[model samples]
Target chain A: MGATIGRSIQCGGHRTLWASQGRSRETRQRAEAEGFEEVTALVDLCAQSDVIVSVCPPHAAAQLAEQVAGTGYGGVYVDANAIPPALAGRIGELIVGAGGGYVDGSIIGPPARASGSTRVYLSGTGAASVAELFDAGAADAVVLDGFFTSASALKMVYAAYTKGSAALLLSVLGGARSLRVDEALRLEWAMSIPELPARSDRLLEYSGRKAWRFEGEMRFISETFESAGLPGGFHSAAAEIYRRLGGQADESFPVAHEQTLTDLLAGAEPAPFDPTR
Target chain B: MGATIGRSIQCGGHRTLWASQGRSRETRQRAEAEGFEEVTALVDLCAQSDVIVSVCPPHAAAQLAEQVAGTGYGGVYVDANAIPPALAGRIGELIVGAGGGYVDGSIIGPPARASGSTRVYLSGTGAASVAELFDAGAADAVVLDGFFTSASALKMVYAAYTKGSAALLLSVLGGARSLRVDEALRLEWAMSIPELPARSDRLLEYSGRKAWRFEGEMRFISETFESAGLPGGFHSAAAEIYRRLGGQADESFPVAHEQTLTDLLAGAEPAPFDPTR
Candidate 1:
């Protein structure tokens, strides 16, 4: 997802590099081999690269923002992590405090490699100024144009229902299996009425790949829903389900999650149906 | 809907009449003019008709079962009321005890005329045997040749999730509106997700007409989910929402609801996000 998004800008005549934590020699070597500068220090990367996009963990979003301009970095500090809107606003504050422009860009749908088609939402102070960089060229991101953190707010509200309903369906199916009502009834109800199976399948399919991203996304959604005066717990509950995936080397992320659910539903006995009289 | 469903059955060469209490005499006269029998006496109709299908209030299902059988009605007794599966099981026992060929059937979909097909899942001791009556010729139904009360059980499960999720979404959206965020971020999240709005529309659209049925269904599902070892209170929560809607007559369940949401969001007034949060 990130690679396609990054390449979209690069091929579109923008000096964009596939910058990472340099977590692996593969990514670092690939960045260098691909004719993009791979800098180890934040100062050099921030100075050289026109846009410094950070896709780190949620808690790390603030710290990452703090360091962008502190290390003699002078560019747009694009915080793309799924932190709470409050946190996003705080990150914006930190970016501006560090003499760097802040853009609260929230990516929706899947990232694409093709130019002028990558779906993203950008908002915040100096958001209107960055339009030529993202909205115009290869990557066509829609401007949320709301409040600074509203983009993240939008991401969280959407997640509460999308992921919440998906989580609810799975949980009920577990109950249904326990009641021994047959899986077909669950599938039929899912297909006929609620239609969350497809969404759940998609989440489970992608969570393995985006487990790290989902973790922060889940937390942001939980707090957002809480702030919005709805159930904060649904996102947290989904987070619990995906908490096992990603951000860990041993965790297989989303694909590994598919295995977890399969195994959980396989040998796992459905709780017996016993309506207490 | 029930009147139309009754008329559809009357079309299939059998002598069928509808006996809805308190319906206008003009309506009955219209049915009679249309070459169909319409009466007020349950015993009179039970004696004349070969099949006594009791599609009424949940509390009335068992009463009809007991009263009709006491009239020495030897015809088929089809209790198609949306009652508890266990209650349906007991009603089946009541009809058989009264020397009637009982078929415990539950209609999952809406009532229909001749065009749209409505399913009748059958159960009980003589369930399969009575398929000849409802599923034999023109009556559109899927008679499950299985355990007694399975039809009702399946219906209970479907209602639990459908209604339960509706309640959850409404409650959460209430939370989202009251949240103070970057106005831009909030709108982005709202537009980004579609599940809550889609579902809100459905609930508001049908709540008034469905309030009574939903109350009974909520009772069955609350127990069924509990039987399945899930949190059962969700349906109870849904029942409360509709019950509130019952007082307003012109409330186009969905329209009134959407307006309520709009007013809440438009005011920018702070309200509780999650009820329990």
Candidate 2:
């Protein structure tokens, strides 16, 4: 995603520099091939670029923000990672205290591997300026008129449905398998909600390999809900489901051909059902 | 439902009788108006009818089956209610011990108010005979080839998604409201999942009035999942959500326009989120 966005910046007639501090050799080669200028130090990249966008794993968002803050580079810092709003607010504080302009941003849809498939939503005072930097790119950069943390909040709740429903379907199908009525339940779904069976298949195709990412993402989403005083048990369970699914390729992900997927989930069961009234 | 099924039985050219032991005056009047023979004594009704179909509330299914079995009713006794398979098996035992032919049945969809909206799914050896009772009716009585309890198993898992997803949306929407991003969350949902905004409102309309029923239904669903060695937390939380909603009308049900719903849910919070790193 970072490479693709950097290419988009270059297409918009701006010089894009990437810090090769801890990146892989393959990524460095790809960045160089994609018209990106790779720099050895984070400070050198910060000093040269007018905007620094952080797009990494959820767990690394804070660490990257802190590293940029330590450099004391007063550039427009856009943290476009999937983290809880409170954590984004904390990162905002970290950047502002270091005399850097902060923009809370979140990317929806997917990576800009193709045109019209992704969007970058930005919030905060510097959001419009940051959006302007990616004008007419592969992804649309839209500025939101809200507090700095609003973009992150939107991402958290939006994912609470997309990935959350996948976990819910997994739980539902597993429970049906355990009860020995999976086919009957699926038939009922077809009669009542015809979209669900296809939707489950779509989740398997798209979210199977991404389950590893969703594990941490759902944990942060759970925290986001808990911070607002709502029950976080659903997404917490979702995180556990994703943890069990891991990062298997889409083709290797278990489908409902037999009882394979449900059997895998059922093996992780804590106990047998209590038959008492 | 009873009236519609009774009319179907009468249309099938059979003597249909109903026991009015504890029924209301209005119900008795409606039973007579719908061509059902209303009997004043339970034993008399049990002795006269060729088959007795038990359709009542979830909590009352056991009691009614016990009452009929105590009368030594040797005819086909069909237990059709929304309950777990274990409870259905228990009711099957109660009827069979008294020399009665037991057929486990479950009704999906609404009551047979008109036509093409309800189905009565039946199982067990006597299911074929019981299905013959509703030869031509507003409701479709389809016999399933399985154990006496398979029909209820289907019902348990099927409702887990239909009503379960409704409760999940309520939690998601109410959480978004608490975080002060309800509109933003709705906008994102509209963009990504076009079905969700209307689906949420549909839940508020249908599930709200029926939440009182869903509270117990979700509890039984939780037990059903737990019996199958799956986690019961989702339906348990769903039961609590419905319990908090408590069967309000749509106008009185809390909406995103206010904070009334989230406040009630937040009251049941266990603990605030720990902000420690």
Q: Compare the candidates by lDDT and give the number of the best one.
A: 2
Reference-based TM-score, model 1 = 0.68
Error of 1 at B154 (Å): 2.6
Which window of 10 residues has the lowest lDDT sum in candidate 2 chain A? A268-277
Q: How well is candidate 1 docked (DockQ)?
A: 0.21
The runs of at least 3 residues in candidate 2 whose Cα sits more than 4 Å from the true structure, single-residue gaps closed, are A21-33, A41-48, A70-74, A113-116, A247-266, A269-277, B19-33, B40-50, B66-73, B113-116, B247-277
Which docking band does candidate 1 fall into?
incorrect
Q: Give a tens-digit lDDT track for model 1, residues A105-182.
A: 766555564543445666766666555566434556666644676556655655556655655565455444544454
Worst 10 residues of 1 chain A by lDDT: A268-277
Q: For this target, which candidate reaches the highest DockQ against the unseen true structure?
A: 2
Per-residue CA lDDT of model 2 for A137-253, tens digit only, reads: 887787765667777877887888777767878777777766667777777778778888887666555555767788899899888877766667778878877776663544564
TM-score of chain A in every predicted structure: 0.77, 0.88
Best candidate according to TM-score: 2
- The DockQ of each candidate is 0.21, 0.38
